[model samples]
Target: MCRGQTAQKSKRAKPYLDAENAEKMGEHLRSDYRDAVDFGGETGLRPGELCGLHANYVDRERGWMWVREVLVARRRVIRSFPKDEDVRAVPLTPKAIEILDRQLKGRNLTHGCGLEHTDGTECASALVFLSKRGRPMRPDGVGACVRLASKKAEVPAVSLYATRRGFATRAAEGGLDVFALADVMGHGDIRQSREYVQQTPTVRARVIAALGQAPPLTVIHGAAGASLGADRDQQPPSETGIEANENAC
Candidate 1:
């Protein structure tokens, strides 16, 4: 008896929220969750990383953030750690800066969560995101919120992690280096990050456009076929035999 399992080919791409769907989802989410969703999509951070984000991680002046820690999500319980035991900095774009500003605008709100430190401790603050009850946010809660918003937005159902995936895909499409993307995403394996650079409709369309830039080729199909742009002297006679009749005349 053969005692082996068959290996399957890896999927070229994973499903992710596109810009339009993300916007629509944002529109349907509650204000609190909307910002969280939008931020997750923009930064490509894991759900735990987003939930654990602290004000200190953001650098408004420099337009970048240090990803120092992440919230660990288990079944019905939450923990803390730095994802993959690695700390890295991710640069922010103008749009990301705008979103960060919006989050900071209401920092004084009584109902917000805090950060889970890498040392297995929780730090309380007017965190970037918080639960309605003023407690640290959890992945399950965020996931539930995403589901409802996607339904209301009438977009394809995608998980909260899809927001992160969307960010990676968009960044890759924007020509960001794959190795850099891996660092930004906190991926331990570069190959894991490469999966996000899968071929999409937009990428395919761009490829076609690029191929069209090549010079056009001309071909003669048959012995009597006229060459493209051929001069009168090199032209083939028409099927009507007009050239022969004219010569006879």
Candidate 2:
């Protein structure tokens, strides 16, 4: 089991959202949880990270959010260290805050029912997104919700992390250096960022079509000399001491 580390993604190439579909998926979500897919697909934040967040984490005026803390062990766990052992911040877009606010308000209105779920956590607890029963959401469960919505959204080849990886890749290509991107992603080694490179189909297709020509090929190795083309038959220069064709006296 991977311990104390974020999950490693086997492939880094992420898919892009066809926004129209994403919006459609919102309809499939339970009324109160509708924002789960939207927020996950927008923030590039992990499901756990989002569920773990509180309003305190947002520094809206500054346009960033502190992400080192989480709703773990049934309480907020703020790490002295970072997710990758380095401090990082995520820019807070108007869209992110908007959806978050809607979720919180909706949750509050729903959970005010004065009933409790398994954890006795109110449906409108301190979490950004809540389960139907007013309890903090499980990250895996959130991912499943998003995935299902994506399918309903008709967004093929997309997953929850696509947002996060897409964010990183877009940042990198937008002239944000690897170091800066790494910092924003809470990563220590930018190389570990292979997982965040968004090689969306559009990008990939453009790359190949832009090549416009075939790539250079290398030596045709593994062929025996006897089977080489006539061009390979040029004889080596005879030594001056050998008098051309005379087999020594």
Candidate 3:
């Protein structure tokens, strides 16, 4: 709230769902934006990570992109430049690599998404993601894109970071272990990335199933009444190791 904004977000605004819903919304994006957003969501990249993307960043042969820079902004319009200089390589799923390859082939070589390239220049000006006008996007532009996507998909609000969260969440829900998910999501602090494990569909369903199954537990706990407890115990138990002992009643 301290970025000098006036209007506060509504308290009643719904919570954001992570990657699954975001992936669903990806279908609604305009082709370029769709690739960008979906790639971001799938790969767990931030807006600056997406915007600062360069042609050479993509290693199509290796099926990975070297993420070297990030555009950190004090504010949306007023922005600083890319900060991560060491160049981190992130694996590209086939779809992600395809998006980068196609964008490079299709868009302006001179200025695409606010980036350009020159032969033998100290740094190739090739920006991987660009606005139609060939300018780097402000954070607000990135946010708005997510908003439009959210509206279309009718899911929770998502941001650049949300993509990262979703990347971790979706992977965990899909059955990735903590170490694997952390590697994919690139969290320097394992704790941050590890948190997404709680959001996994497995975890959610377990919580829900546990809640839904609580009545039997209660019946077993309080009711010595044999018929009622037997009836209570008859509710479908999980295929997993969860045990049902009617005698607990």
Which of the numbered candidates is closest to the native, going by highest lDDT?
Answer: 1
Q: Write the number of the candidate with greater TM-score, choosing between 1 and 2.
A: 1
Model 2 alpha-carbon miss at residue 183, Å: 2.0
Range of the 10 consecutive residues with the lowest summed lDDT in candidate 1: 219-228
lDDT by residue (tens digit), candidate 1, 1-249: 321111111244345777888898888776767778888888888877787777766887988897776654332223444354687888887887887787778566443243334464455544566654445565555666676677787776667777887888888878877899898998889988776664534555666669885432421111111111213233343222011211210
Evaluated with TM-score, which candidate comes out highest?
Answer: 1
Residues 190-234, candidate 2: write the lDDT tens digits. Answer: 675544343333344456568884432321111011111232124
Q: Write the per-residue lDDT of candidate 3 for residues 129-227, one digit (tens) a residue.
A: 655544454444555566666667766545545565556666777888887766666566667655667644466557868887432231100011111
Better of 1 and 3 by lDDT: 1
- All candidates: TM-score: 0.68, 0.58, 0.63
- Clashing pairs for model 1 are 113-130
- lDDT at 43 for candidate 1? 89
State how far residue 132 of model 2 sits from its true place (Å).
Answer: 4.4
TM-score: the better of candidates 2 and 3: 3
